[model samples]
Target chain A: MRKLKAVKITQAIVELVKRANFSLRKDVLFALRKAYGFEKNRRAKTILKAILDNAAYAQKENLAICQDTGMPVVFVQLGQDLKISGNLKAAINSGIESGYKKYSLRNSICKDPLLRGKSGFSPCIIHMDIVSGNKITLTLLPKGFGCENKSQLKMFKPTSSLEEIKSFIIDAVKSAGADACPPYVIGVGIGGSADYASLLAKKALLKKIKLQRGLSPKGTVPGLERELLFEINNLNIGPLGLGGRATALAVNIQTYPTHIAGLPVAVNISCHALRSAEIVL
Target chain B: MKRIYTPLDLNKIKSLKAGQEVFLSGTIYTARDQAHKRLVQAIKSRQTLPFELRDAVIYYCGPTQTPQGKVIGSCGPTTSSRMDAFSGFILAQGLRGMIGKGSRGLGVKEAIKKYKGIYFITYAGCGALLSKYVKSVKKVAYGDLGPEAILKLEVENFPLIVAIDVNGGSVYG
Candidate 1:
């Protein structure tokens, strides 16, 4: 078994928090630029330009990309063969707290949901998977609530048609409109139970936004993502819902096996500033 | 782009139309979810507000902590829709204008039309870029709320696009 110190994990998480907040991912940037080129409306084009410029400025100045540094969500792929010497959860939380303090990042986590009080930095949400390798991989996604609040979950009957599912996805983006910010990245999770479906939807956002020109895998409905993308853009929500062709930068779907009785679907939308960073140790 | 200043003139605001880009200068107050609640409470209770309400432009924002040698941190507009429930009351208090991103509710639109108020939208999620416009910031009230505290900001050439006009016309349409 490979031995790793818990403090080292803490150190890595601190760095990850800073990187995720300050830098917009390159693939997302590429998608935005591509959308900008394809956009015809003058207002939409200008909004896209401002978004791109903001990303650049954030990276150069080492500033949080948005005032909403967002809720810290850490995804850990822990190696089954690795042995840890210190408390894992504490290390991660302390790392986040220290990083936010040191970098002057916004403390967005409330102590309680309903009885909300002063916000502090700590107790980051973590999802872990024990994998085969000896190295641990940590990915941090600071999800902004503007977009997160617009997330949707529907338990469709197993007999539902493909068009019905597609409509639900499209309507999710349409209803989100300009409130969640636009040119969103739509992530769809098409299976599993209720909570798991939502988790899958959020996890799907970690995937890179790339331009692909073909069908999805064999079992799933082919061209579902492409068709949904087309329908969503046609809604004309545009960059900031002002008007244009690039309402969604991409639509990513992840599927899982489930019981025969039901079909669960979840949609997680990310604003133009979709930010995440990952590190392996 | 049209240039406007704080303590906005009603005539100037009336002349503006939805979707018209403008550069705003002068003083504004930053207030988000909690601060708005407190302001509305103060109005109902007949208590004095931290700043005068007449002709003031309130920005829907909760800025990040100020870094060393910086007037403000990443300061950007938040979603306007969240404040819709309190807007009619706030507008009724002789407020002139608001700066935020996204659309407003129908009641808020009706209030804007009735009260002759203006709604402006800056770049959404462009906090770093938007902070460049802020010349200075001072915490005026609600120190306990941290980022949700009310802040007085002096801004220069703050870029904005009129989203809702005094006529109830909306760029969102």
Candidate 2:
């Protein structure tokens, strides 16, 4: 029997939540820089420059990059062999509460979808999975509502081909317009049930734009993400959709073997302020 | 591109156009979905608001709490469309400028044209960076909405993009 290793995910969770609210990830900054380099529209390029500069200033100042720090969301893939030293729920909640309170991060959560505390960062949503491994991997995401409001998922006919999936993602981004904030990361979950697929799609948001190039499995941009990038950017929404290139920095696709006759696809939209952090314990 | 802090009185607001950047100095009010609803209700009943709306600019913001000795935390613009329903009503009460991100639906566009009001948008999610421009905070209202409540803010050299102009020029272009 592979005995469990006593690991505490709380400390890491606390850091992850606060740090995520504090600033954006390094790879996210790199993606923004790259977009700034390649942006075509003169106005869009200028806008991208200011945004890139702001990201750096936000970090050095130890301030949140965006005002809406977003709600605390986590996806935990616990290794079966990993054991908990402390109370997991307390650890998670404490970390989140402290992060928001200490950092002065906005608490955008509410008990009722329509009403909640003035603290923008109330109510947290967490999902856990026990995978086959010795080390636990926890991905924390502080998802902003601007993009969350634009996310969509639906079940398509099993006969839908790759072209159909690509079209759906393009249309989704186009429809969202400038609301979700352009130069975003588009995560598409395909091949899961309607419900499971939405969660899976969000899980895929963990993949940063620069990191998508060399994923462990097959490596390099897959058929899905490559087409998604070309198609969505072609919409000419550009940075902030002010009419120039650099609409989406990247599109990431995650799939699972699903039952026959059911093809579900969900698109999780992430704004340019991709404020998220993670920890491994 | 221009960053300056000046009083947001009627004369200053009257000369401003839509899509023109103005770094508001002096005291400006903040409100969003909840407060807008209340403001509209008060107007409907011929009741005065907590503050006057004539020639005033109401930022559609719900800011985070400030740490000790600070005026505010990361504060940024929100989806302006959500507050569109109350804009026309508020504009009628002499409201001049509304600031938020994202495109306003047709209703808001028409309202802006009719009322000679302009819409401005600051950089979204750059709340922390933007807060530095805030010189001081006078008061907070509707605390129940958390970040969504109202703030009486005084900013210096704040940056924003003129999203919509008094002449009907829109930033959505």
Candidate 3:
């Protein structure tokens, strides 16, 4: 079995956190530029330009794209044949603590949900998967509360029509208004159990931003992604919900097979920043 | 773009219309949910506010830490809707303007009309660019809240759009 040092993992996590916060991915930048071109409202155009400029400033000055560095959501794909030498969770949390402190990132985590107190940015949330390989892959998605708070999951009977599903997404996005930050990305997960469906939706957000908009991965309903994108943009929420043509940049969907009795759907939204980074070890 | 100075008076805010682009300059206070709660509590308990509320522009932001040898960190508008409930209370205290991102609730709109207030929306997710406008920042109150502490910020040419006018007109509509 291949042996991987936990310190190396911790180092990777630390670097990933910095990269994710400071840099806007190329695909995401391209999408923002594309939205700027397609957006008709002059106000929306100005806001998009500011967003693009902000991204450039972040990259140049080594500053976080947004003050809300966000909670570290780490996705780890561990090799089945590899042995981790140190405590995995401990290493992950240690990296987050050190990186956040060293970079002066905001500490947004609370001690508990109801009774809010400082958690010192410890206990990083991590999702792990075992795959057939010798290399471990880690993707860090720093999810801000603005977009995360607006995500929703709904379980409908299998008999629900496609139109019903479509409206559900539309209403959710419309109601979210500028709160979730418009001209954002939408990740949809369909057909899994409640929790699994939401997880899939969140995972879908980490996928590459394609040149083509609303392109779902395999096994999803064909063309549904594109159709939803059109409907959502037509809502006229625009950039920052100030009213315009570019409410959503893209809508990506991932689906899984589920029991016949029920269909679970989850919608995860991401702000225009869409900060994410990955590393392979 | 039109330019507006801080410590905005009711007359000046009332002249602004929804969707008008404006560059704001002068002093502003920074506060998010936690500081807002305390502000309201102070008012209800008949205690002095952390800052003078009359004609003040409150920014809905929680900036990252000021790095070594820096005046401030990346600072951007947070979601405005989260503070919708407390907006009316603050407005009633004689606030002239607010800067944030996103839409406001109907209650906030009504209060804006009743109190003749302005809701300014800045570029969302553009903290780095926005920080360029902030000349200086000093913690004024609630340091225990960390990033959510109330701050006195001196800004120059801070870009914003009037999302809600004193007449209750909203850009989101």
Candidate 4:
């Protein structure tokens, strides 16, 4: 068994949170650049240019990309053979407390659903997966509520057609309008249970944009990813929903085997400022 | 591009059309979900507002804490739809304009038309760039709300697009 100190995990979490909030992943930047080059509408081009410029300034100034600085979503890949010396949950929480303070990131977590109170970060969301390895991997995704509030989940009959799934995603995106901050990076999960499907869609969000921007998958739904991307952009929602081309940067999908009688699909949308970071220790 | 100043009068707002880009300068107040709710409640109780609402423009934003030596931190527009329920009441209080991004619900559009108000959309998620336009910021009320606290901001050459015009033209169309 490989022994890892809990403080090492805590330090890595702090760095990951700081880096994720301050700079966007390279895959997201590449997709935005590609969209900027191909966009034909004047207004869309202007919006895209400003977004890219903001990203540049945020990096140079060591500032956050946006003010939301959403709740930190940390994913931990713990090795089965690893032995942790300290309280893992406490270590993670301490990292969030210090990281939020040190970086001046907004603490958006509220104590209650309806009642508003004094501001502080409470209950940072963390997901853990046990994998076979000697190394521990941690990823931080600062998910803003604007796009998160717009996500949807629906359970369909097992006999449902692929076209039905496509339309469902389109409908969700259409209803989202500009509230989700298009052009979005759409994440879709298919064939799992309702909860599993939703979680799968969010996990799909961690996929590199390089794999989703224009690439399509084969088998049960051949080229469906590319097809959905084309149709959604054609909706003319555009950047900031001011109407133009380039409404979505990419569409990524993850699938799982479902029960014999049901098909569950989930759609999770992400804004252009796709912020995430990862580290291995 | 049109240049407009804050404390905007109805006539100045009426001259605007949807889909036109504009640079707004001068003073505007910032408020988001919690503050808006409080404002409406105060109005219902006939309590005096924190600031005079007549001809004032409110920007819906909750900025991050300012680091040392910076004028302000990253500040950008939040989604407009969440505040839709209170917009009519706020407009009735003599607000001439609002700054936010995304589609406004029908009620908000109706309030804009009935009161001859305008809506503006800054580049969403471009907080770093937007912060450069803000000359200064001061807390006006609701200090307990942290980022949601109401703030008075002085700005120059702040860029925005007219998403909804006083005459009811909508960019969503």
Candidate 5:
């Protein structure tokens, strides 16, 4: 068994947190910039421009791209052949605590939710996946409150159709309105138990920005992603839903086989400032 | 329709049109759930407010830390509806405007119409990208709330859109 160095993992995580807070992914940035060119609404164009400018300002000043630096969500992809030499959870949390403290990131975690009292450090929201390779992949997403507030999961009749799936996404966005932020990225998981659906939905947001083999180009991704994107954006929810044109930037869906009696779905919305990063060790 | 700033009066707010984009400027207040509740409670009890509430624009934000000697952290709008139940009383107390993201409750719309106030929506999740507009900041009250405290900030050309007008026109459902 290959020995894993706790020192390397911890150090990399701390750096990941800092880097993720200050930077938006290049692919996402390019998408936003391109969206500006395609968006015909004048207000939307200006809004997109402002979003681009904000990205620049965030980078130049070494500041979080959004005021809500969010809870440090960590995704660990471990190798089945390797060994983690130390307390993995503790090290990740330590990295989170140190990252927040070092970067002056806001401590958004609370004791019981209802804003009763403060929870000093954000607990690491971690998910571990064992893969066949010998490397460990760590990804960080500082999920802000706005997007998190709008996340939803529902179990439907096993016979539900595509329209019903559409309703769940629409309702989730309408209720979320400008709260979850607009020109958002929606992650949807269908056909799992509620929690599992939500888990997969969250994981969907961490996937590569490009369409892949999992969703066949012609029949799967472009078909569903564009169709849903068209409808959601046309909701006229627009930038901030103060009304314009661009509402949702994209919708990514992933489904799992589930019990025959029900169809479960979850939506995890990612706001315009989708700040996340990943690295393999 | 135009975006106005804090320390403003009802007259300026009333002049704003529905569905107009306003560029916010001047001083603004930071207050979330806790601070809002406290402000409303103080009003009922005839207690002194941390700051005066006349034609003032309250920003719904909880900023991050600025370790490198700065006035404030990443200050952006929180969910507006979270402060919905408390908005009526605050509006009746001569408040002119509220800035946040998302839809406000029906009560808030009614109150806005009754009191001739407006709700403004800023870009959500654009906090780090929006803090550049802050020229100065003053910690007024509720420091204990950590990021949820009441702060006074001076902004220039802060971006916003009028979501609910004095006439009760809602941009979002």
Candidate 6:
């Protein structure tokens, strides 16, 4: 078994958080630039241009891309053959705290859901998976609340048709409207149970925002993603919802098998500033 | 495009129309969820406010921590709809304008029309770029709220689009 020190995990997380906050992912940037080219409305075009300029400025200055540094969510793919020397969870939390403090990122996590106390950095949300590998992979997604608040999930009956599912997804974006900030990158999760579907939807957001992508390896419908993307952009919500052709930059779908009684679908919307970073150790 | 300054009055606000791009300068106060709640409570209890409300513009923002040697950190507009619940009362207290992103609730639209106030929106999720306009910042109230604290910011040529105007005209439609 390969041994790794806990402090090493802490150090990696610190750098990952900074990278995620300070820069826009290249894939996302490409989508934004493409949308800017396609947008015809003068206001929409201007908004897209400003968005591009903002991303560039944030990266150059080593600053937080947006004021809401977001709730730090860490995805850990732990290798079956690797062993850790110290408290792994503690190490991760301490790293998050140190990263936020060191770089002046906002402390957005509240201690309690109901009481709503002061914000702090420790105890970030973590999802762990044991995989067949010798190296650990850590992916960080700093989810801002504006778009996160608009996430929707529905348990459709087994008999529901594809059209119904498509409408549901489109309606989710329609209801989100201008409130969550557009042009949005949509992530859809289908077939899992309710909570699992929500997780899958969020995971779908981590997929690269490519112009051309293949069918999901997990058996999700192939043409549905493309159809949904076309229909959503037609909503005229546009960038900043001022109306234009570039309402949605991309629509990514992920699927898993489910029981015969139901089909659960969840939609996760990300604003233009979708920030994430990953590291392997 | 038009140029406007803060401490805006009813006449200046009424002259503006929705969808007009404006470059705003001068002072504005920053307040978000908690600060709005506290301000409402202070008003209800008949206590003195941290800043004057007459002809004032309230920006719905919560800025990041100021970096060393900088006037402020990434200070951007947050969702304006989240503050809709408190806006009617706040507007009645002589508030002249609001700056944030997204569309307002129906009540807020009605309030803006009734009170002859203007609602301007800056680029959403563009905090780092927006911070360049802020020439100076200082904590005005609720210091314990950390980022949520009310702040007084002096800005120069801040870019804004009039999302809603005093005549109930809205760019959202």
Per residue, candidate 1 scores C-alpha lDDT tens digits across B1-173 of 78999889698778999989999999999999989999999999999999999999999999988888777889888888999999999999999999998889999999999999999998999999999999989999998888889999999999999999999999987
DockQ of model 6, rounded to 2 decimals: 0.83
Residue B33, model 3, lDDT: 95
Query: Candidate 1, B4: how far from true, in Å?
Result: 0.3
* Per-residue lDDT value at A158 in model 3: 97
Task: Give RMSD (Å) of candidate 4 vs. truth.
Answer: 1.5
| TM-score for each candidate, following the candidate numbering | 0.98, 0.91, 0.96, 0.97, 0.93, 0.98
Best of the two (5, 6) by TM-score? 6
Q: How many steric overlaps are in each model, in order? A: 0, 12, 0, 1, 7, 0
Worst 10 residues of 2 chain B by lDDT: B2-11
Tell me each candidate's i-RMS in Å. Answer: 0.8, 1.7, 1.2, 0.8, 1.4, 0.9
- Give the number of the best model, judged by DockQ: 4
Q: For candidate 3, write residues A1-281 as lDDT tens digits.
A: 99999999999889988899999988899999999998888878988998899999988887889998888899999999889998988998889888888888888888788988653666678999999989999999999989999999999989998889999988879778888777879989998799999999999888776666446564345477778888898988888887788898888888899999999999999998898899999
Per-residue lDDT over A1-281 for candidate 2, one digit per residue giving the tens place of the 0 to 100 score: 33332324556776786678776788888888888888778878877886777777767776777877777788778888866666666667776777777777776677676554344455577788889877777778988888988899988888886677677888899888987777888888887688788887787788766534443432323856776777777888876667677888888778887888889999999988887777776
What's candidate 2's i-RMS value? 1.7
B1-173 per-residue lDDT for model 5 (tens digits): 35565677766777676668889899889899889988999999999999888888899998888758766667778988999989999999988889988888899999999998898888777777678788898889988888888999899999888889888987764
Candidate 1 ranges beyond 4 A from true positions: A214-222
Regions of model 4 farther than 4 Å from truth: A211-222
DockQ of each candidate's interface versus the true one? 0.83, 0.66, 0.80, 0.85, 0.73, 0.83
Residue pairs that clash (backbone atoms under 3 angstroms), model 3: none
Write the residue-wise lDDT of candidate 6 on B12-62 in tens digits: 767788989889899999999999999999999999999999999999999
By DockQ rank, best first, the candidates go 4, 6, 1, 3, 5, 2
Candidate 1 vs 3: which has more DockQ: 1
Ten residues in a row with the worst lDDT in model 4 chain B?
Answer: B10-19
Write the residue-wise lDDT of candidate 4 on A110-216 in tens digits.
87767758878646788999999888898888899999998999999999988898999999999989877788998899977999899888888899876443444
Per-residue accuracy of model 6 over A1-281 as CA lDDT, tens digit each: 99999999999999998999999999999999999998889989999999999999988987788998888889999999999899988989988999988888897777888877787866788999999878999999999899999999999999998889999999999988988879999999998799989999999899988785665433245577888888999999988888998888889899999989999999999988998999999
Q: All candidates' lDDT scores?
A: 0.90, 0.76, 0.88, 0.88, 0.82, 0.90
Candidate 1 per-residue lDDT, tens place, A2-103, comes to: 999999999999999889999999899999999999899988999999999999998888888999988899999999999988999898898999988888
Residues B129-168, model 3: lDDT tens digits? 8888999888899998888999999999998888899899
Docking outcome class, model 6: high
